[model samples]
Target: MIRTKSFLSLLLLTALLSLQLTTRAEDGYRLWQRYDQLPSKNHLKQYRQSLGEVMVQGSSPTLTVVKEELQTALGGLLGQPVTITENSRKKEILVAGTPASSALIKGLNLEADLQKVGKEGYVLVSKKAGGKKYTVIAANTDLGVLYGSFHLLRLLQTQQDISNLQVSNSPKVQHRILNHWDNLDRTVERGYAGFSLWDWHKLPQYIDQRYLDYARANASIGINGTVLTNVNANSLVLTPDYLRKVKALADTFRPYGIRVYLTARFSSPIEIGKLKTADPLNPEVIAWWKNKVDEIYRYIPDFGGFLVKANSEGQPGPQNYNRSHADGANLLAQALAPKGGIVMWRAFVYDNNVPEDRAKQAYTEFKPLDGTFKQNVMVQVKNGAIDFQPREPFHPLFGAMPKTPLMMEFQITQEYLGQGTNLAYLAPMFKETLAADTYANGKGSTVAKVIDGSLHNYSLTGMAGVSNIGNDRNWTSHPFGQANWYAFGRLAWDHSLTSEEIAEEWIKMTFSHDPGFVAQVKNMMMGSRETVVNYMTPLGLHHIMGWDHHYGPGPWIKDKPRADWTSVYYHRATEKGIGFDRTKTGSNALAQYAPDIQAQWGNPATCPEEFLLWFHHLPWDYKTKSGRTLWNELCYRYSGGVDSVRAMQKTWNTQQGKVDKERFKQVQMLLTMQEQDAKMWRDACLLYFQTFSKRPIPQELEKPANTLEYYMSLDPKFVPGI
Candidate 1:
């Protein structure tokens, strides 16, 4: 009898211990929604007093979510369950809803405030009603109330004072979206994270909790749309099988005000419609597309629209049919226009057959067809002219296409920024492109203004981020990668917010609010992008990564499928000089930009040192802004990149006890690998370029660990995301 009792006790003890371990583990699954107990007793007391009772008005899916979120967040942060009531007897009560839904809110005379912020915008204010202090979150629609609820929760999570909370908020961009480059096979393209999140085979029947959480996270940051498929689209996704799965996701996301979009394979007509050709002008093809689009709307009524990648990187488009890109886009637009859906046509086209400057080709192709696109069509342009390099000038197409709506496309995945290993905060890089003076409408015309519809006054504007999220326990493989996702959504909502402001907000909500820790981490994040550029592709150097996988240094890469795909074609290194001459002497790509931009970047002497090599090819003996010869400058920049990695390692080491044990160790190990990778980049690039410069390595810098032949011989196999 005693043995039986003891055995039962042992089992119970083990169960209890397992539960305890699960509760304490900081595996980063919560992301920025970590509503931990407030550290300050006084602050907690004040918050509890102000949010003692919640009276959310209306009965809708979104309003219910808002109430539940407030209850959960407030309960977690204040260390007490908040009372939810229809009528508040307490002095301070939280009231939230659209004016139509709440009689009290409508009587509050907030029409002027509602007018200021449109359909998706919200107003949060502290008011006195019937001698009772009430915190009211009001908007014209339920979606806005949901957004305001998140804003209120964010304020409390970040330990900000909410007493004088009179704030009106709305997304600057009409459509803020995350483009998941996830394939039907569950593989993500250029994705460093694990396999895709959508389990297509099981999605319609079985909805994972992660899907709901993903919607919640996106909605919290004001993201209203998500493209669930890859741009290199498969026609199968448009079929009924995939549409059912998509409907399930859309149903899940609808409560969060997020609509789902899919990439439209231009050749779907031939591939799936049983048609012979996908000619945009062909009547049969046009009819087939209209029928297909109508079928999609039947399943997903609130579908955002289509994102098309045509005649670029082997994707089929109207170009194959001798038609313009506008023809291809308008064909799809015509079908979706009646359904209130839009078309996001990608401007990443490059024709290796033409042999023009790869950077200039996008501008050449899209600039001429600017005013020709349909009203629902938005040309999605990458931040830079080239593929997502470590650094590049803003795409000249931003301001040049005045009659068309241009959407900004940013890669949140670290494909070129050291993939999943290095911690590269991308907000600084994004801010750099946004802040660049496009000069499309004289001096004050910025890229941000062009895309925000202020510069061109286009009614439709949007921003799309290539999502880095995946099946990893932490959505992004790297823990710090969460910040990039967070940063992108925040910036997409409001480009006016500084990188430092965003970084600080992320740090406080994700980690500790300790001023010392926040300051140190913010500095690290702010400088991380520049550190990556310095180490990977400094001083106008671009697209020199390894062949195919783009993992490591491959300055010697040559003889690829296309001449432009080769590293030698971009760098153009010779015994006399290193760097591509894009001036009047060579490709004359400089003339594509505004004359003011041309004047600034056209002359190597007057150009910013960061883009020196990008615009002009210089000799080894040429002098730079740093007062060093071209060879020495190259060596310094490469070495400096390695040194910066070392500094990051040291900075992270000091934060050992400041962050959680799981994340701290993970980041620490990743930083060590980053240091090693930085060294390889420095050595491999310097050694290869030295062969052309015919110069000796700087004596002060560390010597190469391995020979040029050894570095060249080392090849990584089965690299992920191939």
Candidate 2:
């Protein structure tokens, strides 16, 4: 009998090992939709008791998705079958509804309040109804209920209390979206993750479970919308066949409060519509857009809006017709307004006709047309005036436009900040911009306040992040990159969340709830962004990337198609000195801000050290707080960034067994890559700058082991996204 028992145990062990191996082989493409069984814990038992049964009050493809998602997640967490019953019991019952479906919900004052909430807004409450204890998730529409269901599941999965829950949260902005710069051919522009998630050829018919999982993850974090195609707009996504495919994704995402948005090809009237011109003001062009909007609405009634990138990077727009950006935006806004959609016109534009100071161009163009834009139009501005750098001051446009609603555009993809190789947590980056005091109206005019439309009484407001998501096992190629997407959604919903809080929450959800592990990882995540900025573009240095790929270092790049496109334009690293001169002596761009801000930033001595080089030109011998000259300070920052990554490696190494083996190993390998990359950045930058400063390597710092020529020769062909 003992021999037989031992053989049975060995057989069971072998079976478990095989299952584990199979699971590990699968990349984390499912993201948080991993419906793996939760550990047997006291919290799981309590949650299961509170959520004994579910009652769904809607029927659609989206509704089916919600029910299946809830069933899968609940089954995994509870380790038991959760029956769905129509009748309410004295015990706890999960109730989901649209305002039209639930009479009890319709009777509540919530119905009037629900009108204020968008179709995607939802409320979760634990209350006694009809003499029975219930956890009810009600929304203005079925999509809202689907979102509520995900919210409830997230709280439960993250080990938050579900009993007596009274959560009524709606997105402050109408369109909280993810802009995927994914090409139809599967190359993602500035995307660090593997390949594009949307396989265009297989899309409409072969609805991958990954699509449903993507919706679940986004809805869990309060993301209400998604823009599927690249902002460098493609005409094909507008075709009837692609629209059908998009409708498939829209159907999958609808119940989860996510509406599918498309990157509008302004020249679609010419390219796709075969018109003579794509002028927004032309009667034919206007009619074409109206018909297109009608076509989209017919397929997906909850279609969010259009994300337009025009007259920037050779893309077509109203400027082609000699009309202003506001003219371009207003035309699209008019087409969509009848269907209750919005037009998010990008504010990132600059060309030879524009002024030399690229940072100030957006403000120069958009601020003048404050009230000119239609009510349904939002000017989407990058966090900084320039592209998403490692560190950037909040865009001046945030405070400048009170009448026109401006949406904050953050890049979740680490375009300039080490791509997917470096484990930089961008929660701090987002928090830095959001918490910045815009001082538009008065003392406390933070960017957050402006974005939520509280400071300005504008009706339309929002936030969008260019997605880093891809066909990776963990969704984001780098595990830490997931935090950026999570942080964007959290901040979009409630811009009040601190970086520390966000890091802690993400660490707990993504890794472990163990306080020791959370604390250690959170510390690394919290400081990671600053470290990258220090190493790469410290003290307001910007846009010094390789010529084409924008990877590693290319501070020596001077000859490109456009002078400004090259790194040399911004760095100004000649024999005399380095750093852009945007002061009274140069572009005088500082004058655009309020006099108080200009006064503060105008002078190098008084200017915040963070933006010192951004505004003022100073001698290399300029004194800093560290008692080192400007040159010395630059070296120290670069060196510090390198050291910080090494320290992060040590911190992560200590977390070996605390996290899942596969994830821990993956992070360890990435950290090794980051350390190597950080060193390369430090060496290449210092070597290049040495030509300008004519200064020896500081005594305390290690000299570059090789020549600048050697560093330059180590060029990587086929740099990921490039």
lDDT: worst 10-residue window of model 1: 18-27
Full-model lDDT, candidate 2: 0.83
Please give, for residues 138-197, the per-residue lDDT of candidate 2 as tens digits: 888777777778778777756787777877767766668899999999999887778999
Candidate 1 total steric clashes: 0
Runs in model 1 with CA error above 4 Å?
Answer: 1-23
Q: lDDT per model, in order?
A: 0.91, 0.83
lDDT, candidate 2, residue 189?
A: 88
Q: Candidate 2: where is the Cα deviation over 4 Å?
A: 1-26, 35-40, 60-63, 98-100, 103-120, 128-132, 353-355
- The candidate maximizing lDDT is 1
Q: Tens digits of per-residue lDDT for model 1 on 301-395? A: 99999999999999999999999999999999999999999999999999899878999999999999989999999999999998999999889
TM-score of 2: 0.93
For every candidate, C-alpha RMSD to the true structure in Å: 3.8, 2.9
The 10-residue segment with the lowest total lDDT in model 2: 21-30
Clashing pairs in 2: 27-473, 28-473, 28-474, 29-473
